[model samples]
Target: MSEDFKKRITVAQADYTKSFIQNVFLQRTIFFLVFLILWQILSSLGIYPKFLLPSPIEVLETMFFGFIESDYLFAILESFRRVLLGYILAVFVGIFCGLAIARYKILDNTIGASLTALQSIPSVAWVPLALLWFGISEAAVLFIVVLEAFIPSALGVRTGVHTIPKEIIRAAQALGARSIDLYIRVIFPSIIPQLISSLRLSWAFAWRALIAGELFVNGVGIGQKLELGRSLADMSQVMSMIIIIAILGYVTDDLFFRTIEKKVQKIWGFNK
Candidate 1:
């Protein structure tokens, strides 16, 4: 609409482009390829025994071959299902707990400190208790995952709610907004950005916790396969499974969570 406004928009676009160029896909690909090359070189020279440290190519071959032998697809699907179930439960519960803590200062001051302290405890630490309660089952894995996923999300939502401008809340109240309407119409919308930011963190925690629990449970999951690989001294299978887990984590985070976050931020006019 104006010359200065047009210049500002152009500058913002250029800055975003520059920042995007400095990070993201190409850099990740380069690093992955370099690591693979180094791995191959070291393996070929026998710096480490092939049984102990299979090359990237060997790992890839084993993964591909496994697919040919049978539908490894089910393993992928099952792993995904467990992670999703635990993560979704955490999201719902976290929102409620976060609202309670953030809306009440006394609760926030007391439980908030405890939640922060709990976060410092690694998710794996809960496995013993979880196993004692649920006994080497999906329930145990889910319990660990929920513990990992819920805490950061709850903290994020609380922080986001607290950070909303006090003037905005007062103005909405002055406009005769009721408490429920105030939260739904004003406060919730304001905190969506921070909530979205925490989803990425929550998913990562869920992933790691899922793997840890699965490893302990020794059931029909990829983590169990990893344990089997270790027991059989099948380094290739172990490496292949690790690669699969990494790829799955990256794809889900990048394609789903990150894409949703970008869209949410853009719609909220917070970022581009």
Candidate 2:
């Protein structure tokens, strides 16, 4: 093809791609708007009591006023703090355990097997044990969060390690790479994409565990606020907290973990 013709084709393809993306976004926005309108109409028609099924506008208002007039802001901050601390600890523990399990046959047969079984348990199932061990304190919540988050992370890392090309390890060994050096230079870099995915999964688990813990533990937290709303028969407040939680989860995944995952995949040539 001529240079001019090739350039036109390239531009046309780029424009088409951009238009497709924009259209998808626009369709989503329209769908969301339609959903909200239907929700409002149903609530207005009294299909359910206002206190039981608050409209979107009422929820939005509650979210606004709750932040301004209530302890919602403090609750959110407390929840975020607990989740962050727990998630960080889980990442460290998970990575260490994962590496050990992957490296040692004994650990692989023991702890790795145990983790696989433990992963089947729901985060909330650990709440009673946590309460007994820590007496409904922050420690109890952190414990649950860490336990819930670490399992998937450790498993993901173990799987990643197993999937690593044996040739790379042999190449590194031939180059005089030792234990720590091999891990730092070869193993870790090779597992970046998997690590990122594991971290994201762990964060989600941590988030759920944190909320479950907070619902039972004593403290200011989003989960506590949600419980409070339920107790007080305030549907608007409950919906508001739900929306806030959803927004935080979505933003965190999209902006941080997803962004990092994409970059790492590109760097590792897993994506183009």
Candidate 3:
């Protein structure tokens, strides 16, 4: 093909790709708006009692005014604080356990099997034990969050370690890399993509655990607000809290974890 024709084809393909992406985004936006309109119409028609199912506008209003008039802002900050602290601790513990389990076959067979089983149990299942041990304190909440998050993180690291090419390890060893050097320079870097995925999973687990813990334990948190709304039969407040939680989860995953994953994948040549 002539250079001019080739260039034209390339430009056409680019335009088509861009248009397709825009169309998809537009469709999604339209679908969401339509859903909200339908919800509003149903609420207005009184198909469901307002107490049971508040309109989107009501929920939005509650969410907006909540930060100003109520303790919603403090609740959000409190939840974030707990989750962040728990997630940070979980990452460190998980990585350490993962490295240990990966390095030792005996520990892998024993602890790894146990972790697999433990992971199947719901995070809330541990809440009772946490309550018994820590007695409705922040420690109880942190304990649940750490346990929920660390298992996935540890498992992810183990899988990542196992996936690493033996040749790379051998090369590092031959180059006088040992112990901490091997981990810092070779193992850790090699498993970054998997680590990012693990961290994302851990964050999700931690968030859920934090909420569950807060629901049971006495605290000023989003979960507490949700419980209070339920107690008061305030559907608007409940919906607002639910929406806020969903938004926070989506925002964190999209803005932080996914962004980091993409960049890491690109660096590792896993993305084109």
Candidate 4:
């Protein structure tokens, strides 16, 4: 390619990346606007009873007033605490277990397959066992969240390790790198992308698991609020809880995970 043409191409690519980020922000705003309009219209049209399918206004009121009266803040905080505790535990265990399986064929063959199979089982499926083992306590909820979050994290790490270039490992070994040094300096650093991906996936898993546990245990959370709304036939509260959850999930994923992914992709020269 001509130097002038290459220079133009580089400038175009930079412009495109900036435009893409702007577009994503615009799209998110547009999406929320569209949803709000549709919700308002549908509720006004009385597709369902107002109480059964509350309007956005009613839902917002429930979120601001009804939830406060119900001590929703404490519930949300408790749920967040449980989810974070379980997620952190899952990350630590998954990393250690993944490294072990990646380093040893025997461990991989004996345990990796079982772990893979277990992933197919929905986290909610373990609720009964968790309740039986730990009773309807925070431990049961943590157990369920851990079960959900651990599998994807472990798989992500294992796959990341497996995808590491053999040449890099060999070169590190030649440089007198022991197992710890090899992983720390070569293998682990090489999989930052996958680790971030795992963190995102783990958050989703744990969130779902937390809701499941709340449903079963009927504890303090948005999930418990959902159950309470259902019992009282209060659709506005239900909708409000759902909206808050969607907002929270989107904000976390976009602000943290997607942001990281973009930077990493750019650094890896894969963001074009």
Error of 3 at 209 (Å): 0.6
Model 3 backbone overlap count: 0
Query: Which prediction has the highest lDDT against the true structure?
Result: 3
In model 2, state the lDDT of residue 225. Answer: 87
Relative to the true structure, candidate 4 reaches a TM of 0.86
Candidate 3 deviant stretches above 4 angstroms:
1-22
* Candidate 2 residue lDDT tens string, 66-169: 98998888899989999999999999999999999999999999999999889989999999999999997999999999999998889989999999999999
Q: Each model's TM-score?
A: 0.87, 0.91, 0.91, 0.86
Question: What's the CA error at residue 116 for candidate 4, in Å?
Answer: 1.9
- List runs of model 1 lying over 4 Å from the truth: 1-27
TM-score: the better of candidates 2 and 4:
2
**What are the lDDT figures for the candidates, one per model?**
0.88, 0.92, 0.94, 0.86
Give candidate 2's whole-model lDDT: 0.92
Kindly report which residue stretches of model 2 are placed more than 4 angstroms away from their true locations once superposed: 1-22
Selected candidate, larger lDDT, 2 vs 3: 3
Give the poorly placed runs of model 4, Cα more than 4 Å off: 1-22, 66-69, 268-272
How close to the true structure is residue 12 of candidate 3, measured as C-alpha lDDT? Answer: 100
